[model samples]
Target chain A: MTRATLLTITAPTGTPAEGDAGFALADFDAPQVRITDLSVTRGDGVFETIAVIDGHPQALEPHLARLAHSAQLLDLPEPAAAVWREAVAAGVRDYRERNGEAGSGELFAKLIYTRGVEGSGRPSGWIFVDEGEDFSAQRRGIRVVTLDRGLRHDVAESAPWLLAGAKTLSYAVNRAAQREAVRRGADDVIFLSSDGYALEGPTSNVILLADGVVRTPQTDQGILAGTTQAAVFAFFEERGLATEYREITADELRDADALWLVSSVRMAAPVTDLDGREYPVDAELTAELNRYLLSRTE
Target chain B: MTRATLLTITAPTGTPAEGDAGFALADFDAPQVRITDLSVTRGDGVFETIAVIDGHPQALEPHLARLAHSAQLLDLPEPAAAVWREAVAAGVRDYRERNGEAGSGELFAKLIYTRGVEGSGRPSGWIFVDEGEDFSAQRRGIRVVTLDRGLRHDVAESAPWLLAGAKTLSYAVNRAAQREAVRRGADDVIFLSSDGYALEGPTSNVILLADGVVRTPQTDQGILAGTTQAAVFAFFEERGLATEYREITADELRDADALWLVSSVRMAAPVTDLDGREYPVDAELTAELNRYLLSRTE
Candidate 1:
């Protein structure tokens, strides 16, 4: 099935009106940024991806807060959240109208702001809405490899310039880790700090269920706080389950009753294997959590 | 002076012939990459910048080698260096022709290859030639701030997936460090490893002259090997000066007889002051090295 896409360009002076269906997904093209644009050239930018369900973006407030935080971390001008909200709204509305109701399974909304061309002093910003990937098969159960992230848990606190918590566009290393996992016959990777602490997955946050308690790595461990994880923890609290954020070691992950990689789109995925060792899949728990997540989003 | 830019797009099926000057610098624009493109959405790409003097790119061989190395580290298919060379040649030629002889200043030639939209398996490749910045004022002497890179010296060896040696487009952290340096009233930054090793600069490689020997951090310290530093060392070797590739501690950097940051475009910039500590300018040595670098390129 062809995924519908919507593009919205937001400039400082002239903001493109919303719901402009004049441009088709195939016809959408980005204006050529100067070759010197730091975003394109050096990956000097910050971005956020939100999941859209039934034409509404989920967890937008948290995402926007994180995006703003990322901008400040990178020393970029604070992005106008209101402008971004309008763009996301327009993009989703346009996508639904063009693709029709039958195409409304799920959509991925992306917001990007780049430090524009050198000396222009203008930041380039855009919003994109596209068809989301179907993760049903993998969400049932998946395999992950443990890879070293090559940094101590304290590095982020000691070095704010490392941009540990900010979701900047310099994701080459993260992508590389994912690629390596695929090559090794795993579905994803769980990155461990140099000192052997389980930090996070390449694109998701690591969650461990043990003794009826839900735990994830502390955000202070230099990992991007997962929005979905936050939502899930809130769900857990509402359901009267214990939730904790603390440093988790690689050994602790192996010893947990169940493991899941959580993200915005994938929601909660049970891990069937890690480093070729089989793990028990808590099918009942996975299903219950997925249902709760969907209901909350609705 | 307005910088001249030339853009060339190469696709899987079609290779745009060389010297196609039909496009103008002002009229050039990059077609919008699909929102699904990993390069744009995930910054999954590799790039190289070569110094162009009188329309000829300097240190082409080393830069190409490093690009290929970077591609390998990212698990990207090996790039066709010949194609990149052709694109560079065509871009330089077209840029010089359109900009006129009066625009004979230095140019920065860049090559980029991004893993294109997901599932297509096609890589997007391009070459850009644009006006270079004049470093005359800053080249005389500059101040630098020391920042922690937040990774130990041996992390790259333990974590290959971190892409430590690869010159990937994920440079947001590097740019942030430089921005912080500027905020601290410095011209650049020399990154120190978490373990207190003087690693490298945000963009350039750090070189220290002490006790009649020139020393730079070993590439194995998770740093990108600097082509310009290699060339300078070759020049030094030819001139009978001793050179060493070994770990230089942060304290050693402050104690060195002289320190310089070397890169493709900026060439060699002497560090006049580091962290508010002043050092004598080795004007004669800096001038002699620049002449050798330029003369060799010519």
Candidate 2:
């Protein structure tokens, strides 16, 4: 498989020249952030990963909007969306030129903006593009375990400093939870708030289908609003399917007719098992949802 | 001020050469980690900051032990302490040889180990040495505000995946708490558990003196074990001063005869105000404690 990485460093004054904007993985070998950069040292940054198909980003507007919200939550300077869009386009163009048309294969386009090195007053922003992998093996199904996120569902309303809904780079706990799930022979983790409310997965949104209705936890419960999940909900609604965003319990999740973890890259992955208990899989629905997600771009 | 930065990268097979062991801030201008590096994308890493005085690192062993503990908590491989020691030595040697003896001026020695670029099977580890500034201005005194950490004191015990005590690179919340404190006209913050128990500061441990006895919160309350605070407690104990480690309340902290935030670099900084309420300042005790900390080395 061919892999490519494109980086465009936006300086304090101007963006990179067009000739200097193409793809190269070797350009990333050297040191980029200062040791004092808060993003590297403290993870004080926000990011978004968009799926690109045929050189077009899926849900570009929504991803940019979410990135802006995350930046606001982090007290970081709002990124210039136009600059990011241009960089993403340049990256996609470079990737296709080098690795051929994306076609069925996809690219993960990432936008990262970090509170730069201390006292420099310049935020370090860049776009990175890489080949997306086939999730068919995972889409065949995944098993997930429930882990305690250790935060009350109502904390985000009162404690904004917790950064509950922001997609900051401070993901050590999430990564550790995923590791714990793998240790328990599961593929992913669904976090439960300390108060027993179902929260979210380590890196994706959790959704359940029951009695012809689709449901997910409310975002006000200190969870990031999932872009892919939003898109899927809209698609389902357009097709005359019922959808609801409300409080979900672990018991309800276990009793659901079907469960799936949704993300931008993987689109939608069916949950075959939960805590060693097998669930009924609706292969037809899963495939249809995947097809809709992969083929639709907004 | 003469500033220097020394980086030593440990490759998959071998470490960098001696000639590449010195300090240069310009060496950090380039990209260090791949965009796919979990350290960059997910903040899946652990780090330590050691204080260096006149080419001698203070409490190096304790810092390394804590770093190992953090790595273990994150399920990362235990870093080779001897290699880190060698790298630190080289950095200090280079700093002193280039910028002359540190004397009273200090150096901040940082050790970082990331999960590395994805799928590379290699961990990115480096030791960075930089000049530390005089914090006499901040150490003279600081104003702090109480903020909710948004977690119960027992959360760490209930959910190990939260990594409450590990000093991972995921410190965005900590940074946000500090920023909020500053916005509230304070210099720092003292985090309180959701249950109203006085926890530690964003980057330091809180210590209070009441009726001639020194006290700090117990580490079991989801707070990092403070290496400097432990050293200070030992020094005070050796001098026949009373000390205790137990649960502390915000009210007790507000009503304390004196309070201080202790850390590796700043040592002990008196907290003059909490939530706009002034506390008594014992200058003689503060100086004596600083003298003991600065004069003693392990």
Q: Which candidate number would show the highest DockQ if scored against the true structure?
A: 2
Model 1 lDDT tens row, A114-178: 77765778777667787778888777999999998877887777777888888988888988888
- What is the C-alpha local distance difference test score of each model? 0.80, 0.82
lDDT of 2 at B124: 76
TM-score for all models, in order of appearance: 0.93, 0.94
Please give the fraction of native interface contacts (Cα pairs under 8 Å between A and B) kept by each candidate. Answer: 0.63, 0.74
At residue A262, give the lDDT of candidate 2: 94
Q: What is the per-residue lDDT of model 2 for residues A158-239, given as tens digits with 9 covering 90 to 100?
A: 8999999999999999989988999999999999887888889978999998889999999998898999999889878988
**Model 2, runs deviating above 4 Å:** A11-31, A101-104, B11-26, B101-104
lDDT of 2 by residue, B1-298 (tens): 5556556456422444675432223354544555667777788888989888666788899998999888899888877776777777877776677776543367778888888877886777767777776789777899999999988888778888999899999999999999999899999999998888999999999999887888999999888899899988987798888999999887888889889999988889998899999987878888888877776555
Worst 10 residues of 1 chain A by lDDT: A20-29
Interface C-alpha RMSD after superposing true interface residues, each candidate, one decimal: 2.6, 1.9
Supply DockQ values for each candidate.
0.58, 0.67
- Report the Cα lDDT for residue A143, model 2: 92
In candidate 2, how many clashes are counted? 7
